[model samples]
Target chain A: MRAGKGLKWVTLLRRVADTQDTDAFAALFEHFAPRVKAFLIKSGADHAMAEECAQDVMVTVWRKAGQFDASRASVATWIFTIARNRRIDMLRRDRRPEPEDLNWGPEEEPDQLDILSLQQESDQLVAAIAELPEKQRVMIERAYFGELSHSEIADETGLPLGTIKSRIRLALERLRHSLS
Target chain B: MITHHLSDKLLMAYSTGTLPEAFNLAVATHIAMCDECRARLASFDAVGGAVLEEVSEPSVTMRADALSATLARVKAQPPVQRKVAVPPKDDVIPAPLRDYLGADGEIRWRSLGGGAKQMVLETSEHATARLLFIPAGTAVPDHTHGGLELTLVLQGAFADEHDRFGRGDVEIADEETHHQPVAEMGEDCICLAVTDAPLKFRGLIPRLAQPFLGI
Candidate 1:
């Protein structure tokens, strides 16, 4: 079943690249659209804008399927990279998105949150994170992975901004030390 | 003083993309020449990737027409290029010194006794912006920042605090930080610097070097 599923996606991608097949496109959309929406929403996007951007991303994927190269990147990575680039561009506009702008304040770092890893590079990073002090690990995750601003963290955890900053600094230092 | 060297905290904040835009810009410029920090940044990227994978997969069935829609769009778009075009060489202004200075800023880069040269990336507008580039085999007069100053080694290595940095090594400095950077035994050393205010020379020779050094 797993192999079949994998084959299905690979075929779907290949066909999407070669023939621009709509049925294949629809299938891909159905699988990824919601996830994309969730990603934007979780990253501080407003509900409406997130939905709009998610649709835009899916449409771009459809149009750009011919650009996909399986050897260099997995379908997920390609899509995620696209999403990230788009998000960065959107953030660079003259007017900023109010909902997406999180403030940076000080707060105590949280405990380590569970991390998911699919790629080997990500796995190495997870191991690196595991080596960090719990305080540093938690702050890093909450600030970066969770998309929470330092200020938000301070407000949420009631920690001083300086303390929060120090924890993150110490955490990065440890992570860098371990990785090195 | 812990030398706010931005604390590892600020560095961590930067790696995680939570830093303020201005601070991020400062650090980004620093990182462009600092390798030790870049490796740490890579690790933070990994942590972010791990978190992304943990999100539960969406449970939904593919609609019959989804593939056709995507395919139709693909037919209309062009192929992606293998690589983005490289920025023009002149546009790739080296960092550190380039950060606070405008692209068209006027300044003089004069060679000192050895290969060391000082060019004021930023003029006398403020007390804090200065940078000195030392070529290979050059020696810089020891000095300290009147404010916050950051040095980023863009090419080759220089030694001061008994540590060596190749390309992309960044050293942050302030009033309390004083070090004389001597270029490695081989190869020219080019460094980009950002200073808050300017330098305060403690010795006569160092004072004489400041104007030419543009410290």
Candidate 2:
């Protein structure tokens, strides 16, 4: 089932990339827009802003589809990257002090070895996350979804700052081991 | 060939897009140089995707015309040509920093005495970023940070009490940390540094000049 879903996503992205196919884009949007909205809202965006950001993410996906390399990243990973970047752009736009740090340098083509293991590595990542202890998982969630700094998480959770850092470091180490 | 790297927490913040812009510049610059961290970041991105998948669909749906509206907007704008900056010929500067440095790549350096010169990059208020050129064997004044300070080695190597940081290595320091960093003798050291607050210089001269240096 995972393979089937993954194949469909790759196909839809390719269609959008190769021919500017709106139907394919619509399918992509249907699958991703709500999820992106939820992700943004979880990161502290207002409801309306989350919705708008989600829409903007989809628009960017359509425009940059041609640049997508299926072998390097899964469709969901690619879309999530676009959503994350767009949300950051929106946040930066709202508070107008910072000069945009848009350049992340050249995107490297995925090494052939990495491409071969991409699917298995993703599966391992999901399984590894599921297996994390509840407390560790909570720390990861706060960092990822709440977008809280470690000190902020410490403040919100009443845990010592050192504890938060150690737990997250250990959890990530586990995830890395499992994925490798 | 990076001997030092961003800590896991910083990488996590960077992956989640929560880091302040100045820190983001440092992280991005390091990632541009270090493939190991870049691969690790991709793994974190995969985790992000998994979380997005696991969450129950948002109760609030997008507008029905959202897809069409997006299509219209796409048609209105020309396809984006992502300008991938060609890396400079010499390894002096990384690609991620080229936009800020511009084509000329010249910096107006202010001497920090003892052969160390610095050029501050204007960024957001959250942090101050600067390019520091330390001639071989010169040491920065002993100082502690008011808040957070992240330094990424761009060109050569430097060693503090903590450890030796080479190209692509990042040294994160905070209020509790105090050390003087000195460039290695063989070559000059160039570092891209981001600090959320001013450094607390130990020496009277540096302390007096701190205001003038604007560091």
Candidate maximizing DockQ = 2
Candidate 2 local lDDT, A1-180, one digit each (tens): 245455577778868876788899889998899888888887778989998899888888888776665444567878887777777776762211221222212343333333334544455555566677788666766666745763454323221223223333343333334334
Q: In model 2, which regions exceed 4 Å deviation?
A: A1-4, A93-116, A130-135, A150-180, B76-90
Per-residue CA lDDT of candidate 1, range A4-107, in tens?
23235556876766676667767777666666666566666666676667667877876666555332223554565555545555554111111110111122
- Give a tens-digit lDDT track for model 1, residues B1-215: 11113335545455445444434555665544334444444344434444443334364223445445544555667544223322212222344334455556544566666656655443333333334567676777777667656666656678877566656566666677877778887877766565546577778987876666544
Compared with the true structure, what per-residue lDDT tens digits does model 2 show for residues B71-106?
Answer: 889888644554463432436667666556736877
iRMS for model 1?
A: 11.0
How does model 2 score by TM-score?
Answer: 0.81
Worst 10 residues of 1 chain A by lDDT: A95-104
What would the DockQ be for model 2? Answer: 0.26
Scanning candidate 2 chain B in windows of ten residues, the lowest lDDT window is B81-90
Best by the lDDT measure? 2
